[model samples]
Target chain A: MPEITILTEQELRQCAAVDAGAVEIVSDAFSRLARGGVQMPPVMRLDVAEHNGEVDVKTAYVPGFDGFAIKVSPGFFDNPKLGLASVNGLMILHDSRTGVVRAVMLDNGYLTDVRTAAAGAVAARHLAPERVGTAAVLGAGVQARLQLKALTLVRPVERAVIWARDGEKARACAGELADELGIPVEAAADARTAVEQAQAVITTTPAGSPILHWDWLQPGTHVTCMGSDADSKNEVAPAVLANADGLVVDSRSQCAAMGELHHAIAQGALPADIQPAELGQVINGELPGRQAADEVTVADLTGTGVQDTAIAVRAERRATELGLGTRVQA
Target chain B: MPEITILTEQELRQCAAVDAGAVEIVSDAFSRLARGGVQMPPVMRLDVAEHNGEVDVKTAYVPGFDGFAIKVSPGFFDNPKLGLASVNGLMILHDSRTGVVRAVMLDNGYLTDVRTAAAGAVAARHLAPERVGTAAVLGAGVQARLQLKALTLVRPVERAVIWARDGEKARACAGELADELGIPVEAAADARTAVEQAQAVITTTPAGSPILHWDWLQPGTHVTCMGSDADSKNEVAPAVLANADGLVVDSRSQCAAMGELHHAIAQGALPADIQPAELGQVINGELPGRQAADEVTVADLTGTGVQDTAIAVRAERRATELGLGTRVQA
Candidate 1:
């Protein structure tokens, strides 16, 4: 067995801003996935109760690689009650040559956060308008914060508005993020006010009901929906999706099942012929991302196994080089 | 993320025989699996090269449980060359409630090997006829040795015959195992000679070609084949399967694809309606295991994810209670 080094949540947070090493891995995974060189097993879900759902397990096997990542993310019930975050996991790296497990990284949804955020950046870089300067963010959760951080990396945002049900949480989140990114971030009174003036809007709430209104979106606005990972969860209104010029998703199959697109299609708001291109195709320049600067574009940001594998691989290497955590040999 | 405990290979080996707690876990896993309460995903395989095959990533989710185990067993080419055992892996146990990763167990295939061996024992206890004494083992590798050890735990074996292509290696394995178990063991020069006098036989080589001949088996002899796990791997002759009065397997789909039954069906020797009983059913008493003392029975053993999850859960608890490894929290 190979020597394995683990990275804690603190280590992962410390390395979050400097994850250039992980970007390459994420890019490679995306390329391999787009080329059909990777075998991702269907994402299995187990319903804990009628109201709560958890991703039972998600896994992928890349042909040339020895190991794969199995991800399990439980529901978000405890987050609000315990003052703790939901969605934690570990990525195990196995040796492809000897079937030996090489490393285990405590992703804690950190890598997931990074890769998903990077993917958001990737989407903004390709799908958002060239002159994207104003942005609106819905929700004050970790995903909402990361999405903003990642969007700023690709697009030059001059001002940003944040809106959440909890006024204090949104204000604090806006203030902290604004200070960190050196951008003007103000808390908006409602979703309509937050998204109406922005060129790019991101909905990151875990609300099952539609939060973003169709009338709030401007003519050239690009909307990135990051919540709604389950069948019952919806972040954007069906009318908003129908008004978009083009829809892009991380994976068409995923978006058509449990994502926001699924709800849109169910409501007959999105046509059956709406075949969204995968994020990889846009990143690889295989498909056109955003056709016109003022075109209304939307990218359904359902996560993928490729992202988990990519970031886990990178984090494992970094943890090893830095002697970040305890080493366990198996 | 939850606190994670790391267990190394050396630590596992040190606790192997002494850890009855881990054995109970293996037992419970089989029981739970037998009860139809566990969901084990299909095992995927990736052939990196012509001679190297890796057991690709596998994940399992049990409903009502917060975490799942992701297993990655890489290719096994370098182990023999490096004078080390091949097939090492780790299991990451995450919190089913929060998806926070809880522990990383460096199984080093120790838990896998043990659970597999325990499954063999379970099969023998249910499939084999009572009053069995002599046993024949084909191949003197690690699995062959474990099979004998586990079989003896459930059956009162008086003597054993071990056979391998290399006589010296077989002799060494037989001598060492016999000394450990206090049973008479002899190294057989040929495959047929090994099974000629034994009432039970186990084939554990990775030979693609047939090793066990049908004519060498007695009428009532029980055969357990555990070597064939990939599309290109087979151990027993198809004629042996044809001659068996009853056939059983861990999973029918898996057996039809990669087990000994796969070879038989490929050669048109066994009909598609062969309808092997699932090991789970037999264990749960839903299907009869062994009927007649003079009936030839064969059990095709392909490893399962339930075993990995069961063993990992058990090992984690035991290791924690014993304070056996280093724990890191995030």
Candidate 2:
């Protein structure tokens, strides 16, 4: 039997990160997906209502790639009461050439957080305004901070605003982002205020109701709706999606099934039969991105297996280069 | 983050097994499934034709169970030419209470093999004839050997016959089973000869075409079609399924989607809308198994995520009892 390598979170963080070329890797993966060069199956999502938790299993095999990843992401919503962070999981990468598992990434959800942030960066790079000064994020969470840190990889921002249902968490998130990114980040007075003052906006809250509305958006703002990955979670209003000049989704079918697009279609704000263009098409230059300087664009990133596979491939390569894992036969 | 436990194949073998109460655990799981207490989604199956590889992700949250399992099973059909076994993978067990990962069973496909074999045994315990002196198996592979070993836990078998496309592999399998089980096992002249001499027939090949026909079975013989889990794989002919006195499937929906029943329905031998009795129903005593002494019963084992979760829960319990596996926070 072939041996397997185990990469812990410490090594993974040292090797692959959201700040370091993750946007490029995930951006390329999206391009391949749009070009029909990837084989991605429908995600296997299991809702463990007993624990108020849900797990989504995602995977994809990219043609010509030597490896693929089966990512297991679990969100335990009620974990905070027990002093737990509420989300956890890992990614298992296999040798696509032979179907042999080559490495087990015990990332404990860090990889997912970074990859998600990178996906947001990819959206910002392709759709955001050329001269972005200030950015706004709806949500004070790991992603709120990580997304800002990641967006710096694509768009330059001098200041940022954070809005959250919990006012204190928003202030804390803003402070953390300011310290980490060395930029002027502060809490916004309201979601509308945040949306009106920024050239780019990223929604990262797990809100069950519409938190960002169409009327609040600036004319040329590029919005990355990144929270509505489940049926019950909607971060942006349906009108916001329907009113956008350009709308792209990670996967049209998935967006229609579990993302913000599903809620929009359910509410009759968006047509049920509309086949939205994938963000990959925009990234691949097959579709127009930011066609006009004042065109309001929205990218729905419900997440995709292709991103997981791409991030994992890069992580493994970097892990190997740094000699940062233990090879075990047992 | 909660700690993660890694249970290797060696420790898994020493702690838990298919013959040791797996049927009871899996049988209970099946009953729960039949009672609508299992939250099992559609399987995520991705086929990579470049390597003749296919990876299936199956998971279920069985209500009232303290944990669930997400199983990643891969089959690379061309691995045998490189002197490697074609099937491999692992199971990730998560705590139901907090949605935290409890253990990683690096069984190297051992758990899958055993759980599958145990499912066949569960079928035999409920549906097979009372008086079984001999058994026959088509296709001499890992499953072929494991199924016989598992069946012994449910029925008293004195002898067995093996038939395979490769005559040499069949002879070798027979020799190995005979020496291992202390029973008179030998290769059959043909599939018909094997079927004619046994009370139970288990077909375990990944053949794309049918190997067993309707006319090949005796009166009172029970057929377990265990190989046809994919759309392109078949073990028994459609005519055989159409002619059976009783036809039960592990999962009615799955069987209709991509199992032997799929082929039968496609060929018009079985009605497309006919909802077959689930093996769980038979196990739960909600439906009849073998109605009469001369009745021919066939069980289509498409496999289920419920069984994986049940087996994984048991394996984790046993591993914990044995004080096995390495614990880490990653």
- Which candidate ranks first by TM-score, i.e. highest? 2
Q: Can you give the lDDT of residue B88 in candidate 1?
A: 61
What's the TM-score of every candidate structure?
A: 0.88, 0.96
lDDT of 2 at B33: 93
iRMSD, all candidates: 3.8, 1.1
For candidate 1, lDDT tens digit of each residue in B87-186?
Answer: 6666666554555556766766676777777778878888887766789999998888989988887788989999999999999999998998899999
Candidate 2 structure quality by residue, lDDT tens digits, A38-122: 8898888898876788898999998867899999988899999999877788899988977888888988888888889999988
Whole-model alpha-carbon lDDT for candidate 2: 0.89
Compose the digit string of candidate 2's lDDT tens values, residues B194-255.
99888999999988988999887889999999898888888789998999999999999899
Q: Report the CAPRI category for model 1.
A: acceptable
Residue B257 miss distance in model 1 (angstroms):
4.3
State the lDDT of candidate 1 residue by residue for A168-211, as single tens digits.
99999999999988989999999888988899999888889999
> Which regions of candidate 1 deviate over 4 angstroms?
A18-32, A35-41, A44-85, A94-102, A213-215, A237-243, A263-275, A316-323, B18-25, B44-55, B59-69, B76-85, B94-100, B237-243, B262-275
